[model samples]
Target: MARRERPARVPPRWVVTGAWRVHRAIYRVSGGRVGLWRPKPGRWGTLRLTTTGRRSGQPRSVLLGYYEDGRNLVTMAMNGWGEGEPAWWLNLLANPEAEVEVRGGTRRVRGRAAEGEERERLWARWREIDTQLDELAALRSTRTAVVVLEPL
Candidate 1:
């Protein structure tokens, strides 16, 4: 019998490009109708947040994974921190005011950073949902943050 080769667990950089292209395409085609589907019992919701670009201060689109922790939406600046605080988080650091669209409505919110015990707890849950995060941690450092969406 011949031996079979296994592929790398993570997609190549170019494949990430393609996946993002598809994501954008679906966002447009469905007017976000076929996109941003939130699975039950976890923080898999796609938060459509508009923030000023950290450098440009121009409006930017950020679609990040979110978990509901009581009254707040919990997420870290990293996907287990592949690239360190994503641009979106940087933007919030520069300007805390931003707009967020979730499920069916849009609202304005104030961004908050999380650390110590609180951050540790939320991140623990994150790791639980996606075990792949542990492997990625070896490649880079990850920062955690919690954004509070004030009801309008």
Candidate 2:
């Protein structure tokens, strides 16, 4: 069988981190008018996820890329394709319940890591949107968690 080639390396960590910071800053400066977007055909959308901080017990919000699956929203804890787990994922693990702001409005959600065949299925779905998904995931030492946000 022919082996699939890996995608090019991602941008420097600082670049990736800085981009996210800028995105969040725009969301903040706009007073929630211009950040979140809806998923269009063959592309993922952006949403603002508000997860309670695991240690601080404070509301922590971050913008994430997600796509709708049935009535649920699906995302990956890729952490900018960095090595360690993202804080938002850890916070979700600590407290599964959270809130999300999408293009439509706010919704209360329960988060969980997809596993087994469910995970494989969702991963495949993501791959369709992101052709470099596997290559980016391979940069990390551990498997990225495919997070499913089910409506409460």
Candidate 3:
């Protein structure tokens, strides 16, 4: 795993919120061009994830930092160092089918939580790239979900 800059153990809620607003806006405004290229200090390459809302049945989109595992796209449900699972992860659990855009290309994918050894391997990979993994996890009570998106 390549070393990468990591975020603070627990980022301020306002910073997290503000960053997301800016990231999402850039992603949408450029039609998945600008946001995916800028790898921020604590983030890797960004991807635009579109998931079907569990209740609203509407499409919900978010910009996330992600890594690649073979053909799968990997990301954490940390919600920017905040507590609980993010809505995108919850939505994926309800309906695993989703679409993601990376480097200006879109693909259909099915989401699943990595389990046992697979989870361990992936988590270790994250730790290697992100020095703040443990500290970030400590900030939250619940374990973060390691989500994998496999192309369909």
Candidate 4:
């Protein structure tokens, strides 16, 4: 009997990295004006997050979709729905201090991983906006990390 050939799977890491590269390029080439707007209707706004590289100790910026929760800004560390955590989240784990730009206003914030009930509450808000939250998360092996940035 002939063996069936399995379809090739593109590594999620490469996909996520490539996406960030393109996104950063766009943000940069646009002179900080474009790519600063919120996402589509029913979705959250976007923010520019700058985190210190854990190993290199350099600044790294990435645009992330975010929602305002009271005095905190909440974002997911899914790395574009990849199987691994985003680098920014890792940086936050190493050092929770970071800077974020929302609506052209920059602020220092302390990042924290929401746990237990807090996480569920924030995740539920995301689900309200993104109906595919669970479906997208199912693609990854680890549970998604919900990060809350508290202004300092």
Reference-based lDDT, each prediction = 0.69, 0.95, 0.86, 0.86
- Stretches > 4 Å off in candidate 4: 1-19, 39-41
Cα lDDT tens digits for candidate 1, 30-80: 887766755356436777778889799799986767767776766667642
Better of 1 and 4 by lDDT: 4
Q: Which regions in candidate 2 have their CA more than 4 angstroms from the true location?
A: 1-6
C-alpha RMSD for every candidate:
4.3, 2.9, 4.5, 6.2
lDDT score, candidate 1, position 22: 81
Clashes of 3: 0
Candidate 1 global CA lDDT score: 0.69
Among all windows of ten consecutive residues in candidate 1, which has the lowest summed lDDT? 143-152
Instruction: Tell me the tens digit of each residue's lDDT in model 3 across 1-152.
Output: 99877655555789889989987887678865577853444456788899999999999998888888888988999888787789999999999999998885899999999999999998988887787788888888998989999999
Candidates ranked by lDDT, best first? Answer: 2, 4, 3, 1
Q: Cα lDDT for residue 49, model 2? A: 95
Task: Estimate the TM-score for candidate 1.
Answer: 0.79
Top candidate (TM-score):
2
Model 4 weakest 10-residue run by lDDT: 4-13
Q: Residue 63 of model 1: what lDDT?
A: 73
